[model samples]
Target: MIDMDRKLGRWRLRVWGLVINLVANAIALFGIVAVVEGGSPALLIIGATLTVVCVAALAIPPRSDS
Candidate 1:
C-alpha cells in the first residue's frame, strides 16, 4: 500500500512538472516572437530564466522520508 502511494505521488509530481515546463516553454516562445517583432528583450530574458529554473527543478527528484 505504501509503495502504491509513493508511486502515485511521483506520478502526480511528474504531471505537475510537465505542465509547468509547457507553460515556461510557451512563455519563451512568446518572448522570442516579441524580440523578432522589435519588442523589448526583457521578456525573453525573463522567459529564458524561468525556463532554466524550471528545468533545473525538474532534474531534482523529491526526497523520501523513508
Candidate 2:
C-alpha cells in the first residue's frame, strides 16, 4: 500500500512539473519574441540566451531536498 502511494506521489509530481515547465517555457518564448520585435540587437541576444537556458532546464531531473 505504501509503495502504491509513493508511486502515485511521484506521478503527481511529474505531471505538475511538466505543467510548470511548459508555462515557464511559454513565458520565455514570449519574452524572446518580444525582444526580437523590439529591434534591439543586444536585448535580443540576451533573450535568446535566457530562452536556451530555460529549454535546457527541461531535460534536467528535478532534485528532491528530502
Clashes of each: 0, 0
Per-model TM-score, in order, reads: 0.65, 0.43
lDDT string for model 1 (1-66, tens) is 122223445476556666777888888889999999999888788878888976776676655752
True-structure lDDT of candidate 1: 0.71
lDDT of 2 by residue, 1-66 (tens): 011112344474445445666665566566677766875455445555655654554455545532
Candidate 2 residues lying further than 4 Å off, grouped into runs, are 1-11, 39-66
Model 1 alpha-carbon drift over 4 Å, by segment? 1-11, 62-66
Best-performing candidate as measured by TM-score:
1
Error of 2 at 6 (Å): 6.1
